[model samples]
Target: MVMVKFLGSLISVDEAVNKATRAFKDLVELRIIEKTVWDALYYVSAEDILALIDQPRYDRSAVDGYAVISSDTTGASPTNPAILRVKGYMSPSSTPEEYVVRNGEAVELATGAPLPLGADAVVMYEDTNRVGDEVEIYKPVPSGANVSRKGEDYRKGEVLVKKNTLLKPWHLSIIASTGINSVKVYEKLRIGVIGTGSELVEPGYKLSSGQIYNSTSVLVKNYVETLGLAKGKYYGVFPDEKEVLREALFKALRENHLVITTGGTGVSDEDVIRDIVDEYGEWVFRGVAMRPGRPTSAAIINDKPVFLLSGYPVAAWTGLEAIVSPTIYSILGLEKPVKPVVQGILARRVPNTVGYRSYIRVTTRIGPGNKVIVEPYMLKGSGILSSLVKTNGYIILYENIEGYEKGSIVDVILY
Candidate 1:
């Protein structure tokens, strides 16, 4: 077997990702569309949302108590209580015109009730006693106490949500507080996943001795869906032949907003996907300086992105996450999906090449004395899919780091 040389110098993972994803930044601005706040979850906001009005809308009671002229309750105590006439009651739906408080008067107000026009503070019910037609405040209450002032939460012109925000349930609530039922968001981009190995077969089908079931498509598709920025469409596997792969690539690109092809990215003679991409588009990067995904490549044809990923499941996943995912976040102005991380002591030493970034799968356990211990599954297995399944999280050894020593504290990113 003849060994193959890299097409050019390897680029840092960061630079490779920038080139692969940011090339199509122009397309994101065009995808702005209106969606109901309920349907906008996970979609990137297209514009800054300014509050239409003050958040409280009006001064509101923060407790179930008596809305009163705060000065009337001044100097009141258990032995010498201030007495005030009970003007009326106010519920959350009560109109201010009906329950206005006057001098030495109070209105019984429930929590969230709009403060009566003349009331300056609320004396909680527990601190007052109700008499025939008057209430006695046992404690002095200051002005603005227990009152949610108008515009306190958000000013009328303040930004409720910034442009390119990933809308969450709380974001929807804030938008709703502004009386906005719909929001402008970038529509979910369409991504096509195509496989290019002749030896690949569909799952559940009888495979020949040399053939393996295609798993990269499943990996890429679900990953895109979970990432929430794009909708993945799989265009069935194709042969490595140039004509077949070319047709497949064109069809997938035309049908989807972007395309990522698995397999046919190696340096071998049969790796003709690179040739097809070079013939039609400009190469963004031929390879990334990372282990398990050194063959990762990307190109842009007519402003559309096409990522070439390895057929190996782990490598394909790494390429999608390390490159494709970050690019989507950076170019579209969406926050990247943050993985939960834990701090733990390394169970064993893990080595890495100085120039390559490595993602080491690991499982953690609570060892003696409640110490969190991280166990790396394997240090070198690009094609071993089971390693990912057995591991619950991963620790990233950056390009400059050689390795981690056992018993050293490290951060683990839990999937």
Candidate 2:
């Protein structure tokens, strides 16, 4: 193993994601999956679905009526009804009876029954009188009136589903209706989360004077699951020891497609993650040009990705949203996930440092004239976990932009 110093040049969010995507471009595999197991899997279709057998497959009645040709009911009136002989009955069933209506005849049928071969329209029974095997029509009908034509819903050779579609329940229904029982989809990427710090204790354990409960593992796990990008497993916390951390990293790399660690990548002497990465892996990038999550780093070991995030809750979250999530989706060839946002007026002015992309947490309320007013949370420390709970979302200040004025409108990305 060779040691390499951390690269201090900070890249933009998009550049970081592109680099990560290039690294894992060929990492995921495609598998043939049955419809039964595709309920909630994140996947992209492997090929184009060019056709579907005609929907409904036949012309059927849209209402309960007598099937007749349009011309047969010509000049029909209440004073002098057009009389016709009743042919037969047609019902909607697995084995429907066949009945043909000639020029001077009509067939009685229920709603959704296939139209007889010679009928071009349907007249409701309300407009007719039944006397023995004859019926008197009182009104006229046009061709295709009250008829569900063949291929009305969908046609054969029509595109059923496109390639790279994220399958939903309705999408599955459509595919099933076309008689497709299995499909090829990109497999989900597996993620392993680990929290690191000597002073950190697992939740439910009594903390000593200098100890804090572990939250990053659970937070990262929940984030991964909620995004539907990958399945995540928590590996608890690792201390500031090189050998233990190295062993844990190796184990995680072997077990998962990607590994994420919270903490121990900063410049302080106690931060050992950077050192371990240099000694045991290859660095893709060591830092990003973003506030709060400046210590974020990425590496590859044994052909698996590893993301080192800040121990601070807010910074860890930012890293996941800004970098990790996009990379995962890119590798899977899925569209980038977008957070819901609303435009609002800033309640106060905010300052920012040049060349750093800043994320400011804010709470929103309805203002005068029904306008949304955003109030920035004053506490800006990345470690303040409660700030995240107090705010609904954050507004991003671009790297080149300084900040926004008190009344300026901005987009707030929701959590």
Candidate 3:
């Protein structure tokens, strides 16, 4: 007979986090790996990335115009324009030595061209009427106008990218600006991802009447990889049979720093991972008091973390997002990345269970006066993956909160 119980006591999300990460303040010592800047995308930097050279290296024109002495165009305007003789033509390829703007003279230079000596400003072509060698400057420009100064972006040895950063495209460009080709980044945390349940089958194969696709494995694997903290090694679906999952659990724990198992949780006969955790591992938490993924859990086995998540897609997502991600960040001594939040007026009343922290998916639309309107999808189901798919972001109803009424402003964290 199946018995329903929390072998390890249920706890709040915050308490679970405390329990899991309390002993791991100085736990980080991951190996650093060198990667080409091109391949460093998404990897966390292990060292401070410094700029070797100044951006631009020299002052350059910011627009295609006539480089001029700022004093020559003083008080110049459309009615009483300053007429200067064009001294020479200069492109970005031209060296500053190739041209010089003396008194009453201007050099026709393209955008990004090196600013010629004796020229303190650039008057855009649109503001100048050029006829033959003479150009009428209708706009007076101050010194340094329309010019990018040397060392304006970065000076040598300045921090371009800080250590432990998730490197993005702009970070790579900044590094590339200083002619850097390689970066030192932390090696990926290897995680073993396992899916459990006799009814689960991999996609591309026939699903019998009692079977569903093992999408949790795919979701967990991809999500873990996408976070850039870890690379997932998938161990395929296993049945509810205790000995089989027991062997897979031990083997995976031996090979990875973290092991995540989906499906074998909750108070059911088929939820065997919880039993394995109780018998052979120490539970950080067996349950969390949250909606969708109440059975989300964590344990330490063989000196590594093992997270137990739900089988239902959306619930599994909540388990990973709400509990797993924060736990990982805590253990690694990394700050959790903040999600973009947008505030909107509620379109309808959305109530939450008093003690449960609820995650409500929402679709936002621009209303009158450019105001954002949030409509909560009230179809409450832990298994409702489609609800998440149809929404752009979600709102959290904290444990202390009850709900939001119509027209109440709410903050939505973008997915």
Candidate 4:
């Protein structure tokens, strides 16, 4: 395979994502399967929304306050209190056979209890005075007070959750209220991760003169799982041998929907990953114009997408965020993966390079004027893990502009 080098261009992040997804759109398929709600939180597939219907068909109480006929306390005032006898009490879980709420009678009820047949409103327990089962109300309440009318929270057959929503605690509650125990969701994306470098050693091992710690494998694996995208298996670090690299690349591509590797993507003597992908797969864009991640590589191997991330910690992370994330989401058939976009003020003047777009690490906070103040972390080297640990987000210096002035309106992607 002849190696071809291409200088990266300054492309809009959104446009790049669109172009990349369109290039390989038909290769991945979405499979929706029915699964119990209890087993759905393990991965992205189970978190997808199928349907969001309404609550049960009944008028229920929203609070444990009280149940009353609104008309009974129409003219009741603090000076002249209205007293009534306690007719009965009702709990949420139990069904009450007797629903007779006569005038001058107040019924006790718990939170989520269905409104009695005759009660048109409810007075809170705190607002009423009960002297040995005799109830006294100082204020008058209107009809439907303290009551959740039937179909009020949600109407029957009303769709609450749209398709592709990531199920949260509230979503699960919605499903349970809608009487749905199971839902249809998309299948999770399977990811394989390979760390390339002969000198790299895994953590918990003694450091030698010729060895470095293998940080990329664990980092990439955790990164994939944190997004609820996929379960990643780390194949550990391999040497620069072409045959070993080829076997690892081929195996990962054949089994996983996506394979992401760190190290060996740089333009160095030991960088064999890009060459391996070039030999085995259809190479896509091989480089990006963004600093730190300029050496990034991408290709399709055995019909599966493969990404060769930079050996630098921050670069690998940035490239994964900018490229691999969207690809995974698209393969899973998710419409839009919501990312946190924050607007901030540049604390100081930012100098930029002429042709290369820069991603500067920044620390963001709300200042005295309630403005988001972003302070640059000032670390630009690709291998600086300490900078990433201290920074909160990234600030972009566009290719068109030379630099940014203090107090400029800048948009940032919050980490």
Candidate 5:
């Protein structure tokens, strides 16, 4: 068995992420996913798309009026309106007639109707009176007024959406308008999750004297799916035995691109994850200098990533947010996900250890002068899962910073 070298000092969060990114930079697999333009909502584009056809397709009217030459209605008013011969009516769907508006002629058309040949402007009916076959145009219009020129919205061969763009609703509409029926998107990542511990039991099962319900597996699966990062497959709970853990880890590694296991990462006798990593995998990092998740570890088995997170609910969650999530984003060619945050004043003094990064959970309320007041959750233990439910988000204390004083303005990342 290979002896594992545990780094004496913990690495910073940025260093850890950078290392993981380099390890998996060439591992992201790209697949062409064909989706109909109508149902392609929220799918990231795999390639840049060019317009196949122009919008409007032709010069059209923008209102229900008469199409005419601008020079014909020049200097016309109510008192001395320009009189022009009225031609046949034109609907939006009708083909443009083989006719032209002479110096003193008009063709009545509805909104969106194609402009007849030689017509450069439109005169609203409200500004003119009709008598027999002639109408009076009271207002003067310039060339191209009230006209939507062909290719005005988008020209053919113009780039509509760039590669790796997350398609929104409006993007789908635009693609459809360009006559594109389908688009290509990247495939979702496949992630395998395993929760290990002899004392762990699945939810709805009766727990024995030393057993607790297995919550981390479900949490990991749901969190991965909800973020649209990957499809999570839970392999159920495994005992702390080395052989059993090894078999499960090997199977998960073979089946998924990435694997995550919660529990058995600490330095206790039952913590068999470290030994398994030493025996069958290459250890990347054994720990990070972050509170609530100091024992988080990562390894490479058969050239695939395997993250070992703490069993405690809060610690497991922190590891996922700080480590696993960033790695996945890097693989997907996306920018790091940003958490919504609010600026607030710390309501009380909080102490922390220097050289260790801290995540302090806090609840917020509107205080005097409409200022947001953040109240830190007193219970800071990693095993206290209830604190997560009670607090909206957490405030980060950097590794070099000791703590925050009362009334200090800070940014709180919301859940």
Candidate 6:
């Protein structure tokens, strides 16, 4: 029921988050258990993995190619090739018998064969012509040519990635090369999502004249799932009646670590979540100084954080970012999630509100001279979902800033 302000009582986003974080002060003992490598794809962590290992490891080659010394082929060219007599071939899986590459001799090497004594390079068969016992090298192979040195891709004791990193395929490859069988990652938090509105109905169900499709429930669920941070449990659609919404919120708060409710945080009479939460729980903070998401609400109910987010898709997303995400991060003991930010020139003028920070969707790419050029997406209303789909990300307008002029450098957080 409280509308947060900035002047005497209003706090900036940074200050607000800081205060909220300090208020908690490690109140929750939730330890997001570390998952194995196989589970890393589904869950991200708040800790870096590189800080765990202490060893030098290398991935052996998986190919078959000659490993030879390089200095012997310097003057060898395609026109006047250098010829070296075939000494012998070494196969992998068996210890290689040491054979010195005398100036005019080429020792055959299987893929992954360690460089023989006195050999520094390997020339592929395609680049050489063989006549009887002698091979003609057409290209000048440089020293260390075609060689994957010890720990070229990874080194001993090198922290591949820090804790709290989302494991990608490339990250898996790096650790796999280091002979790491499993990894530690934070466990995914469970989220309970409740949607409340008498005018709302589930998409597949038959709807009456006054009922609209339930968009908030589905959108909130999808957003939570997409981040790999939490699994959402929908409590179905409830009516705007205080008793109905209150019961749903109560159940959600009890069952999950985080409860996110969409569509009932606005100022309209239909909005009942704020009043209900205020009656049942202590309000951490309410309202924010951001456009399209001003009606955001936060509270701690029965020891669990409850977020009553705005019904507008963008507003809901912002509310989640401003309130819910920080709680999730703290619960999992993970670093703050950062949106991809880049600097670009504004393609046109963008007016701003004086007291509120505005986030505008934008399309950006590297234009002439490799400079980033960002054009603001034309859609401005909180109701337009297509605008977000069309844009790559958002550009921020500070609370005190009036507007942005064309050609001005702006920072954009890419989608």
Error of 4 at 295 (Å): 1.6
Superposition TM-score, candidate 3 onto the true structure: 0.93
Q: Please write out the lDDT profile of model 1 over residues 1-415, one tens digit for every residue.
A: 9596788899999989777666767754446899998899978788999999997878999999999999998899999999999988889888667776889899999998999998999999999999999999999989999999988999999999999788888998999989999999988888999998889999999999999999988898888888776889998899879998888788888878888889988778888887887788888898898877888988887567888898999998889878888887777766676889999999999998998998888999999999999999964567898878888998999989899999989999998
Best model number under TM-score: 3
- Per-candidate local distance difference test: 0.87, 0.82, 0.87, 0.75, 0.85, 0.72
Ranking by TM-score: 3, 1, 4, 6, 2, 5
Task: For candidate 5, give the lDDT.
Answer: 0.85
Residue lDDT tens for model 5, 230-347 = 7799988999899998898889888888899999887676878888887778877888888878878888887888888888888888888888788778767887668899999999
Q: What is the overall TM-score of model 4 with all chains considered together? A: 0.90
**True-structure RMSD, every candidate:** 2.4, 4.7, 2.1, 3.1, 4.7, 4.1
Which 10-residue window in model 5 sums to the lowest lDDT? Answer: 1-10
Q: How would you encode candidate 3's per-residue C-alpha lDDT over 1-415 as one tens digit per residue? A: 7765766556787887787776333333478899998998877898889989988888899999999999999999999999999988999898888887899999999999999999989999999999899999999999999999988999988999998788889999899889999999988788899999999999999989978998878989988887877889998899999999999988888877788999888778777887887788787778888887888888777677788898888888888888888877877757889989999999999888887888889999999999999999878787887778899999989888779999999999989
Q: Is candidate 1 or candidate 5 better by TM-score?
A: 1
Better of 2 and 6 by lDDT: 2
Q: How many clashing residue pairs, candidate 1?
A: 0
After superposing all C-alphas onto the true structure, candidate 4 shows an RMSD in angstroms of 3.1
The parts of candidate 1 lying over 4 Å away from their true place are: 1-4, 26-29, 77-83, 129-136, 335-338
1-415, model 4: which lDDT tens digit per residue?
A: 5374553654554555665687667776557777676766633434424334445356677777668888888778777878888877887765645567888787888888877778888888777887888888888998888887777778765676666666666766677777778877766667889988988888999989999898867778899987774778877778988899889877877777778888887656678776777677776777777776776767777887777788778888878777778766775556546669899889998888766677888899899889899898876687888778898888878777888999898987777
Worst 10 residues of 4 by lDDT: 42-51
Candidate 4: pairs in clash: none
Runs in model 2 lying further than 4 Å from the true structure: 1-7, 28-40, 50-52, 60-149
Could you tell me every candidate's TM-score relative to the true structure?
0.91, 0.81, 0.93, 0.90, 0.80, 0.82
